[model samples]
Target: MQRQSIPALTMALGSTIVLALLGGCTSVTPPAEPVDVVISGGTVYDGSGGEPYLGDVAMRGDRIVYVGPQRDLAARRTIDARGMIVAPGFIDPHTHAEVFLNSPDPEQRVNAAWLAQGVSTVMIGVDGGGSPDIAQAADRLETGGIGTNAVPFVGFGAVRSRVMGEEDRTPSGAELAAMKELVAQAMCDGGRGFSTGLFYAPQSFAETGEVIEIAREAAIRGGIYDTHQRDESSYSIGLLASVAEVIRIGRETGMPVHIAHIKALGVDVQGQAPAVIAMVEKARAQGIEVTADQYPWLASGTSLEASLLPPWALDGGNDALRLRLAQPDERARMKADMAENLRRRGGASAMLLTSPDLAWTGKTLAQMADLQGGNAVDTALAIIARSLEHGGGQTNVASFNMAHSDVDLFMRQPWVVTASDGSNGHPRMYATYPEKYDAYVLDRRTIDLGNFIRQSTGKVADIYGIEERGYLKSGYFADVLVFDPGGYAPRADYLNPRELATGVTALFVNGALAVENSNPTGTTAGRVLLRPAPANCQVRPR
Candidate 1:
């Protein structure tokens, strides 16, 4: 073969470079690559914690093929996203979306509340309520066709309760061993980690030492220790001590520690967010992995039982509590304790009924007491008694114990990402991202729009170790959304807590359009997200 002339070679190389650049402003699939969907001409927030840019995102199947300047690529669908903010679909680090995910109704299982809020993924099995049967749960989620992706954490309380019934005592050697085995099995079966609601009973019964021991199994299997903590208020060891306990747990186990819905709960702990932030930063500085999630709400929801009853009194579940309430002296003792708890939660007027009893759903505890012609304590006891008689879990309240200042302080922290400790009877279940964006980002400018998106998207995915789904980058999964900033705000409020949020123009889960024209397309494109199995993971024992 004859060698080409220098001018011919230079021209050929120049043409190749021009073609590469024309593929898109960034490295992308060739122009010949088929794009299933093209979201064009939008302000793109790539979830990189960076400034927004005007760009296009092309999707093919379940993956993003390109993200760059306007491309003249052919696509099956084209969305004119002009005047909208196009970003990675938000990832919620903590949520009780299980209520929807586990619903027998297919519509409920579609998880529209979260999908409407632009959430592509949610962490379920939160607050120590996860099942150890991770495989079974994953199978159900996949086969049932959910509306948003889910990550499951094997719960410490779930295993502990199964191994040892609801008792306020130390676990025997065999029981402890059994619980550890369950944690190992769950982790091996693809659970995220060991989660805890140590403030709740049976779980509360286990000492921190016991928890550290059980959580080590998760650590060994490369799982993070996610907790609702042992205390978030002046209950038990107090808030600061609780933070320290989590830090120590992380340090001791050599695992990451995530404080679920980290906050200064109750009057005694109000205005303590700064200190908590400092503690977490210090731990992080020490090379201990410590991250936290926070909801934007001033009120935290819980059952009357979880809020007012003492952990000891809650021992052995509602049956034991029923027996205790049946005894006059025991009832008197419980009332005294509950009265203090009510005060700690900022008085009876601050507790708003949220569910079950329609007649009293919107009333405060004080209002209910006044109408019932009884003191707050007596009214609370009566409600608890009635719930127990009806097989329990009938009462829930939104306790307005957090201060705006504290919430703001927590939100401003770099490590504190957005999450909804979402549950039934709370507006957060339907609208947390919009609420934060509307009130915190747009109104107060507490953090800029970029910060809000980062906190809600990449930051959460990074913290949870979810691979390849939080950013609109080349080769990432196509979990993307388009929203109108002017209209993306929460519809749900304290009084009307179930309304779906508005202003999501389009949402795609795994490259399938789940929402179009701000309406659900009724596509169940969600999957059970799983990380790579830990190298140390062992087969679960039979």
Candidate 2:
């Protein structure tokens, strides 16, 4: 059949419509097409650092089909989100989430701790613990199922340990080459970046040049460099110097530098937030991309051994440490060192043991020391020895080291996004989002609600280059949240750290309703988010 001209087709169709109208035959109205879900009458934040607006956001399947003012679109389910905040689901850039994310039990894997905080996505394998075998890790996550999206990185600690095994020595030329290959391989296997906890040992032994060389692999492959800088206080190179090192890494490697849990930690660095912020801004102006994530809390949680012991003591693993603790001269040397370190972190009373299922869980170090009729250092060493003798686990403590003013200063920075740094037996894992909202947004008014939401959502995604998952926009993934203002607040504190946050009324992961009416629907709708591998290399199949 020949195609009709536009005028001819229009004339014929117009005549037919005219005849039908004349006969009153074009009278029946067609029904509105139903979309999968319509979220109506909410104060939408949109995650763009914009003012809140009353609007509706519509989702269909795994992507958003519409997001704007309502226009009578039909829907299978309409969520009346009146008086609630509709925003993109939060992205936690730094988290030790693998504790729950890698669990075999579906319930633990659901990650209710973060789920109730309105988080739809979490970056796992953080703090220099990310897997080099990212492909296999992703495969396991997808196969076993999860409730929140997970991204992976190739860790400096993991790679170095694989090559050196805590030898406290620089890598040989061949060893360094081997480590670089592992980084490149991991990047090709879809790692988003290279992460280092230079503050932690084994990795601490790696100097600036070593880090630059190792991280350069990730840089050339288009991945960022994330680090928990070598020191946040006057511990080693000093906080300011450590920050400079992070910047130097970026300037040299040509990769963006991200500081994890940026803070002015401990009594020694109590008022250094402004200086740290200035350093980051200066670096950014110099064309080195720098960003950081912070949890809204006063106390910083870390293992007691990490906080007190020297890296040299941790050189040959727990066995060597046990030997050191037993030697008279070595033990005396460690005691003096620990005492000085104790002074660096406030005093014994400033450290509260928080590791779960332990006899010393709730007491402050000072109290424990008093009970044992010993000095803080001796008491601490005793605990470490017992812990090592039994199972070689870390004696974790919450150091009340950060000043409120310092925390406030860091929180106000635009480049600093929100993260949980969520550790076991810590309230931050479950309540960081709500805590920020309740304490910073609602009470202190340190940041307005829209800025808070933007920092938690789109800002983080922008910093990390997350594809299509951090905005309530058309064609983006349907990772969204609806929460009641009155109900959304932190339920956990140091005294009761594992309590789940309250008031995420509706949560969607990839457009699936993972939580409805503030209850989980038992759906593991998460996916393994991977960056595209380098074009020169084929990604290892998972």
Off by over 4 Å in 2: 1-32
lDDT of 2 by residue, 1-542 (tens): 22234344324323432332233211122224567998987777788875566677888899888877655778899999976779999999988889888998989998888888999999876778887999899989999999999988899999998988887888899999999999999999989899999989889998899999999999999999988899999989999999999999999999999999999888888998989989999999999999999999988989999999988889878988999988999988988889889999999999999988887888999999999899899999999999898889888788889988988888888898999999987789889999998787666768767678888999989988899989988889999999987678788889789898888989999999988877778889999898887777667666
C-alpha lDDT of residue 415 in model 2? 90
lDDT of each: 0.87, 0.86
Question: Candidate 1 lDDT, tens digit per residue, 415-514?
Answer: 8899998888889998899999878875666877778889989988888889998999989999999998767778899989989899899999999999
What CA RMSD would candidate 2 show? 11.4
The model with the greatest TM-score is: 1
Candidate 2, residue 398: Cα displacement in angstroms equals: 1.0
- RMSD each, Å: 9.2, 11.4
Spell out the clash pairs found in candidate 1.
Answer: none
lDDT, candidate 2, residue 13?
A: 25
Model 2 reaches what TM-score against the true structure?
0.93
